[model samples]
Target: MKETLADDLNLLSAFCGVRDLTDLSQNALYQKYQLKKADAFVLFGGSILSGIDVLITAMNNQVATNYLIVGGQGHTTNALRLKINQFYPQIPTKNASEAQMFNAILQLKTGKTADYLEEKSTNSGNNITNLLQLLETHELKKDGLILCQDATMQRRMAATCSKFAPNTTIINYASYKVKVMEKDNQLHFDRKLLGMWEMDQYITLLLGEISRLQNTPSGYGPAGKNFIAPVFIPQDVLAAFYRVAKLFPNKVRTANPAYAKSLEN
Candidate 1:
């Protein structure tokens, strides 16, 4: 039997949790958890300048009195740094944490500073762990929270945060441009329309995150006991994930070795 577009969309929707993404407007956030009631907001770093833009907007809107930027250099630091330099040539990017670079841009754009910077986190998991530790160190309690991350990362971020900080009410806000679409019988993006990252790179990250959402020993969620995320994967979504992997074998295989191995078992 041949697969239809509905099948593909159902799988994609299940994997991406499209409902969550669409519900991330300012109004939705306010409806769920009024920002004014929150002690502070957090920016989980990775996408460099784009992530900073969201942070700055949150700051400008008075989302909260305090804001935290968390991240250390990962795979995309250099590319992000280069983009930062293009806008603010004088601002130093080298040897700076994602928080520091984002702060510099924030200063340039809004003439304000982030309240805290946790520069030790190296990936999504640590982004939560380090920030939680920082909150403890500062004696700050997150009553209500606004977590700003790449749109593609909202699901994982929410899962991890829920597992670790169940008391806090988290309102997720992310960009709408970072999306996955199918065209010409293949997965792709229009670079001219949304030029945040290369199509191949973006797809890789998307698939990698999908792999991490799996409830398996090799996954990063609860099943793996990594304590990073607590995501539930519907069987149909898992099937779609495998189908997509088969469609883009090279990219999916390279993006997540464990996902490939899981299929073998």
Candidate 2:
């Protein structure tokens, strides 16, 4: 059977777990987090350049008076390192952090760097863990913050932040992007590629997120014990995941071994 672009979009959307915040009432139920009370615009660093763009725009727009760029070496960082070295070969990729790479890009773009940078976190869990330590050590307050990351990761980011920093009011500002389209079994962003990931790479990363979203003990977040993602996954989304898994067994196998095993069972 041939899979259509609709199948791919449906699956990718399900896996992304992007929350629809529109339900929150405008006035009291949902009010913009006051930038004045925020400690900083918290940027969760990764290979996603769009996310960084949103962070930069927020900074430039004075959404927050300060900024905290947090990330260490990981898959995303490694990919970003390759992109960074393509232009600046002098900067060594080894032991490179997302913050370091982003700082370089920021300097190249605006001739400046972040107000604070933590370069030891390798995952979302570590992102929050290291950031909390950095904030405390630096004597930063926990009044409020605008959390920014890949749009696909908004739910997980909220979950992690809530678990780790319950006192800090986090306002999520995610990267904006159109849905990934599939043509002849290949995924491509309609606009421009956000970061260093290719079509297949994006598929794999998104599937990995879906695996983590599963409410199994082995998964991450509130669903599992690995991380603290408290977001709920509706039944329709789960059905879409299974449908896509059926279409791309190899990718599901590689990106989410745990979920793959579950599917097999």
**Residues 1-265, candidate 1, lDDT per residue (tens digit)?**
8765435544553455322324434555566555444567787667535667667666666666578887776656676777777766888987998888888877887888889998876666667777888888999977777777665566777777887788877666654343346667775543333226565665556666778777688677667846555677777767766776676666652332221222111
Off by over 4 Å in 2: 1-11, 14-31, 34-37, 87-92, 183-186, 194-196, 253-265
Best by lDDT: 1
Encode model 2's per-residue lDDT on 1-265: one tens digit a residue. Answer: 6556456555565446443322212231134442343577777776376556666676666655678888876556666777767755665667767887777777667777889998876677768777888889989876676677776666677677787888777766555545666567666666775454576666666666676766687567564664664666777666666676676666652332221221111
lDDT value, residue 133 of candidate 2: 84
lDDT for each candidate structure: 0.65, 0.64
Each prediction's total of clashing residue pairs, residues at least 3 apart in sequence or on different chains, is 0, 2
TM-score of 2: 0.80
TM-score for each predicted model, relative to the true structure? 0.79, 0.80
